[model samples]
Target: MDQFTINLLFVGASFAIYIGIAIWARAGSTSEFYAAGRGVHPVTNGMATAADWMSAASFLSMAGLIAFVGYDNSAYLMGWTGGYVLLALLLAPYLRKFGKFTVSEFIGDRFYSPTARLVAVICLIICSVTYVIGQMTGVGVAFGRFLEVDNTTGLLIGAVIVFAYAVFGGMKGVTYTQVAQYIVLILAYTIPAIFISLQLTGNPIPGLGLFGTDLASGEPLLQKLDQIVTELGFNQYTAHDGDTLNLVLFTLSLMIGTAGLPHVIMRFFTVPRVADARWSAGWALVFIALLYLTAPAVGAMARLNITQQFWPNGTDAQAVSLEQIETDPAYDWMATWQQTGMLGWEDLNGDGLIQYYNDASPDMQERAAAEGWEGNELNNFNRDILVLANPEIANLPSWVIGLIAAGGLAAALSTAAGLLLAISSAVSHDLMKGQLTPNISEKGELLSARIAMAVAIAVATWLGLNPPGFAAQTVALAFGLAASSIFPVLMMGIFTKVNNKGAVAGMLAGLLLTLLYIFLHKGWFFIPGTNSFTDAEPLLFGIKSTSFGAVGALVNFAVAFAVSKTTTPIPARIEDLVESVRIPRGAGAAAADH
Candidate 1:
């Protein structure tokens, strides 16, 4: 069968499974809609959390960024994976023991203030909405490429599918569907890496193959890659060349953001017990690590593969002739991806050859002058395209390519569903039922949840049509918001005797400051021409807006403490609630209290 048909088959089959699971696990009540009726097994919840946490950015764009930036990008790997440790250790069990349907509920009740819950709902909405835009964009890109549709149409199709599962099944449906998604995404990701690893390093494990000797060159795989890329005027793959402070801050931001994200936190509430929440986090990491550990290997190996393909003989040889690219089946992936305007080349010197290398290097400039080359020909290789194109680049079977298409869609849709659920629950449960309409019926609450989800999807799709940045970068902004606003308040609510006034003040400070910083640098509301400063000229202490979340979080902590010192103490009942959540004992009773 042709590639298009195979892609449809795989992607279609995966969607069918998700829809079926949603039907089977359709939520019957507000409890099922919001918390999966609190009956999910630990292992099952863990897999679901992995699928929910690892969005399109993790599956589609992260390795690609690592591939282009090398060791300097290792922070993404460490920050994202390490955040789960913080979650498992500090947040998950305690939150689970609190037995709330939403994170905002916990914050509101803990602080004994509807205003605090409302602030949390706003933060959750901002963070979830920002994060969902990235996922919607990913869905658009994946659907556009594989289904041969325009991005807007592809986005609509994806939105429809997500609406079907998310609205019908709620958290119950999303959880079971995410388990299926995790299976598809992991298999699609690893199978290609395994094949590429075996071909390049005589090892089946991509992680080991990344460090193992290259079979042809008899040198460490990374050493060979560093030598080849440097020969082509690119930086060494093993060197760290980015600003050290920004790197540290960015990593810390992602870690804290991961722990604080409402969507991931909500997953813990679905499991049966506080102990289950803890174990579920560990299992989630195990599933997440399967891809996380292999990602660097995929990035390094794919970079090497692309470099080798460009220079068939060696970097010293003449560039690949343009005629070869036009006529050779090996170069077909470029032509295919060029349709998306993401990968392209031009014969800049009219030499009828393609030179793919770093054009910004001074040494490369001198060599180009000596060789009568005008400029680099590969002018627009988008980082997001790397993983989706990996199987095609390696000439893998048509089925593997199809599987990858399915996997990318799964990754995008699962996270979109998860984020939408968080947004909906915050609006319906926390904002409306908890505060505005306390007498609302359970059926009315479920209806409101569905309506909130539909609105959130529409908003996300609209923003995705004109995304401010790539999938991962936009997601990073969401993380920054969460890191600054939600995570700190939760920690204080659980660990400290922070009063309602203090919690309210801290959330507003963190949320406003972080959003202000992001808007100034990333464009006002992420519109293209509204920004006063670029990331290269960050206004705050050489700290890029992307890395400012950690600082914002610190400001939240300090200000909350200072504000609390001047305020009244926590009420006796709220203190008892805090003490109750700190221990796993009587979690069953606590869960039943609401």
Candidate 2:
């Protein structure tokens, strides 16, 4: 079959499975809609959580970021995975024992303040909405590539699919759908890596192949990669080149953000017991690690493959000629991707040969002067395209390429649905029922949830068309907001007897400060041309806006402690609530709420 037909068949098949699961597990009540009736198995919830957590950022863009930046980008890997440790240890079990349907609900009840709940709801919406933008953008990119449509159209189609499952089936449908998505995405990701690993290092395991010997050069894969990249005027692949302080802070921000993200935290609420929540987190990490461990290998090998493709003779040899790029079947992938405008090349200096090297490197400048080259020809290679194009670069089978198309869509759509659910629940459950319309019926709340989800999807789709960065970077901003505003409050609420006044003050302080810092660098309200400064030179102690979340979180803790000390202590009842959440013994009884 043709590539388009194969892509359609695979993607359509995966969507069919998701829709089927949604139908079979359609949610009937508010409890089911919000928390999957609190009946999900630990293993099933783990798989669903893995699929929900591993969004386009993890599945599509992370490896690509690592491919270009090398060791400096290891922050994403360490930060994301390490955060799960915090979740499993510090948050999941306690939150699950609290027996609430949403993170904001827990925060509101724990603080014993409607104002506190309102603050939590606002924070949840901000982070969740920011997050969904990345997912929508990922959906656009995936659908655009596979269906041969524009990004706008792809995003709309993806939004519709997400709406059908999320609005109709709610948490129950989303859970089962995510389980299936996890399977499709994992198989699709690993299959290409296995093929490429065998071709490059004669090793079937991509993770092992990354450190194993390269069959071509009889040297370690990383060593060979280092040599090739440096010879092409790029930094060595294994060296750390970014600011040390920024790297540490960025990683910490991602970790805190991971623990604080409402959608991820909500997954724990779906389990049957506190013990199940703990075990579910462990299983989620196991599933996440499968991809995380293999990602660096995918990045390293794909980098090596692309470099070799450009300089088939060697870096010291002449670069690939434009004539060959246009005519060679081996180079057809470039033409295919170029149609998306995410990949491009130009015969700069009218040399006709594609000098795909780092023009910023001094050594490359000297070489370019000698060779009559003006600048780098590979000027528009979007990092987001790396994984999606990897199978094609390695000449993998058509079926495998089609599988990747499905996988990318699954990754994007699964996370989108999860984020939409979080947003909807925050609106329908936390904001409306908990505060605004406390008397709203269950049927009314369900209808509101569906409406809220649709609105969120629309907003996300609109923002995605004008995204601020690649999928992962944009998502990192959401993580920053969550880490700053939500994580500190949640942690304090569970671990201490902080009063409502303190919680409210801390959340607002963190949320406002983080938003201001991000806007100063990224743009006012993230509108394209409104920024006064760039992240390249942030105003705050040389820390980039994206890395400022850790500082904001610390600010939150300090403010909360100071504010609480001067104000009233936690009430006796609230204190008892706090003490009760610390133990997991009553979890089975808690599950009876549904």
Candidate 3:
């Protein structure tokens, strides 16, 4: 079958399964809609959490970043996995023991202030919205290529499909649907990795193949990649040429951001008991580690494969000819991807060949002069396309290519569903029902939750069109915001006796400052062209905007403690509440009301 037809069959079948599950398990009550009726099995919840946690960023974008940015981007793997440990061990059991339906609800009750709840709702929405944009970006890319449509049209179609499932199913629907998605995505990701790894290194395991010697050069795969990239006038693939301080801050931001994410936190609320929440966290880590271990191998192998495609004989030989690109089956992936407008090249010197080396490299200037080349011919090769395009670039089977189409969509849609659920819950449950309309019935709340999800989808689609960076980088920014505004307060609420005023002030101080710094660099609300500065030359202390989340978290801590010292102490009853959450001696069933 043709590639497009094959892709349609796989993606359509997966969507059918997800939508069918949503229909079968459609939520009916507030408890069901908000926390899956608090009866999800620990193992099932863990798989679902893994699917939710490993969003478009983890599945489609992180490997792309690692492929291009090299050793520096290893921070993504470390920070994200470490952050899960913090959430599981440090936060999940306690939050479940506290027995709140949402993170905002927990913050509101723990701090004993409606205002604190309101602030938390706002924080959750901001973080969730920002996160959904990355998912949208990934959806656009996957659909744009597979559906043979432009990015915008693909994005619009994806938004509608996601909204239908999310609004119909709510938390109960999403939890189970995510489990199926996890199976599809994991199989899709690793099957191709095993194929590519065996081809490149004679090893079936992608992770082991990453460190194994290249079949052609008989050198370590990383060493081969390092030599290949450097000769192409790019930085050595194994080199760490980034700012140490910024790398530290960026990783710290992702770590905390992963913990602060409302959707991931909401998974713990769905379990039957506090121990279940802990077991769920542990199992989620195991599921997540599967993808994490394979990502570096995918990145390195993909980089090496692509570089060799450009220079089939070697980097010392002539680049791919226009005729081969036009007619060869091996080069067919290029024409298909170029339609997305994210990949392209030009024969700047009209030599009938596309030379893709880094023309700006000082070491390449002499080569350019000798060859009489004008400049580098490759243009607008977006980093986000690396992972999605890898199977095709390696000339894998049509079925493998089709499976990747399904996998990429699942990766993006699963996380987007979770994030939208978080946003809808915060709006309808935490903000509207709890504060604005305290007397609203459960039916009214449910209707509003679906409506809120629809609105969020619209907003995310619009912003995704003008995304400020690649999928993973854009996601890191969202993490920064969450780390700054949400993580510290959640930590303090669990570990300390910080007061309501302190929580509110700390949240605002961290959120506003981080948002402002991000806007100055990324753009005003990520509109694309309104930015006054670039990340390369940051405005202060040589820190990139993506790295500012760690600083923002510190500011939140400092501001919270300072404000608390000058404010009233926690009430006696609240103190006892804190003790109960910490000690984790609780009833079997979680109380329904927050």
Candidate 4:
């Protein structure tokens, strides 16, 4: 089959599977819609959580970041996964034991204040919406490239599909669909890496091949990559040159953000018991590691492939000819990806050839002057396409190309559906029924939940059509919000005797300060032309937006402690509540009582 036909078939078949699961496991009650009735098996919940956590940011953008930036980008790898360690140890089990449907519910009950819950709900809405926009954008990109449509059309189609499953099926439906998504995505990611690894290093395991010696060069894969990249004016593949304090803080932010995210936290609540929640987290990590371990390999290998393609005779030689580029099947991935308008090239010097070397290279400067070259001309190569295009670059079979298209869509759609579910439940269950209309019937609540989901999908779709930023950029905001606001409040509720007044004050301080700093850099609500500092030279001690989340989180912890020490302590009964969450035994049947 042709690559397009194969992609269509695989992507269509996967969508069919997801819709089928939604139909088979349709939700019936508010509990089912919000928490899958708290009956999901640990293994199944683990798979579902993995699908929810590994959104387009992890699947599509991560490798690309690593590919272009070299080893300094390893912060993303360690930050995202290491956060789950905090989740598994300090947060997941206790939150599961709290037995609540939403993060706001816990905040409301723990502080005995409706105002606290309302603030948390606002924070959750902001974080989830920001996060979902990135997924929607990812869905559009994945669909546009494989389906041969414009990004707007692709986004509309994906939004309709998300609305169909999420509005009709709720969490029960989303859970089973995610399990299938996890399978398709993991297979899609690994198959290409394994093939590329074998081709480059004669190793079948991509993860192991990353550290193995290159068969062609008789040098370690990373060592070879380091040499070439440094030779081209890029940093070494294993070198770390960014600010060390910021790197550590940034990693910690992502970790705390992962633990605090409501969508991920709610997955733990769906499992049957506290121990199940713990094991489910471990299983989630294992599933996530399947992609995480392969990502660095894909990034490093793709960098090598693209570099070697440009400098066929090494960096000292002339650029590759346009005739060679057009005729070479190895370059076919470029043509395929260009249909989406995301990857482009131009021969700036009119030499009928494209030069892709770093123009800033001191050696390249003299060579370019001698060779009558202007500057690097292969511009606008979107980082998000690297992982998706890897199979094609390797000249893999058409089926693998199709599988990757399906996998990218699966990764994007699965997380989009999960985030929509969180948004809907927060609106209907936490905001509407819990506070606005307490007397509403279960059936009425279910109806409102589905309606809320539809509205959320529509908003996400519109944002996707004109995405404010890339997936990684948008998700960074979401993490910053969660790390600053939700994480600290939840930690204090479990570990300390912070009163309602203290918790409320801490959350507001954290949320406002983080939002202000982010807005100062990213523009108010991410709109253009309203920023005070460029992202390249941000304020707050020169901390970049990506590094601000950890600082915001620390601000949260500090404020919460200072406020709690001066105010009235937690009541005796609230201390008992804290102790109750710490224990694991008899936590299989959690009570809603505070």
Better of 2 and 3 by TM-score: 2
Top candidate when judged by lDDT against the true structure: 1
RMSD (Å) per prediction: 0.8, 0.9, 1.2, 1.4
lDDT of 4 by residue, 282-393 (tens): 9999999999999999999999988888878776676688888889888888888887888888998899878886788888778789888888787888898888888888
User: For candidate 2, lDDT tens digit of each residue in 1-594?
Assistant: 899999999999999999999999998998999999899999999999999999999999999999999999999999999999999999999999999889988888899898899999999999998998899999999999989999999999998999899999999999999999999999999999999999999999999999999999999999999999999789999998889999999999999999999999999999988989999999999999999999999999999999998998999998899999899888889999999999999887887798899999999999999989899999999999999999999999899999999999999999999999999999999888988899999999999999999898889889888888889989999999999999999999989888999999999999899999999998998888899889888897899999999999998999989999999998899988999899888887866754
Q: Give per-residue CA lDDT, model 1, range 456-483, as digits (tens).
A: 9999999999898989999999999999
What digit string (tens of lDDT, one per residue) describes model 3 on residues 1-594?
788899999999999999899999899998899889898999999999999989888888889889988899999989999998889878998999988788998899889999999998998998998888899989998899899988899899899889988999999999999999999999999999999999999999999999999999999999989998999899988888999999999999999989999999999989988889888998999999999999999999998998898898899989999999999988887887787788898888999988888888988988988997888888768878887888988778989988988999999999999999999999998888898899999899999999999999899999888777778878888899899998999999999999999999999999999999999998897877899998999999999999999999999999999999999999999998889898666735446544
Off by over 4 Å in 3: 587-589, 592-594
Sort every candidate by lDDT, greatest first.
1, 2, 3, 4
The list of candidate 4 runs beyond 4 A from truth reads 591-594
lDDT of 3 at 189: 93
Worst 10 residues of 2 by lDDT: 585-594
The lDDT of each candidate is 0.93, 0.93, 0.90, 0.87
Preferred candidate (lDDT higher): 1 or 4: 1
Please report how far candidate 3 places residue 23 from its true position, in Å: 0.8
State, as a TM-score between 0 and 1, how close model 2 is to the true structure.
Answer: 0.99
Residue 138 displacement in candidate 1 (angstroms): 0.5
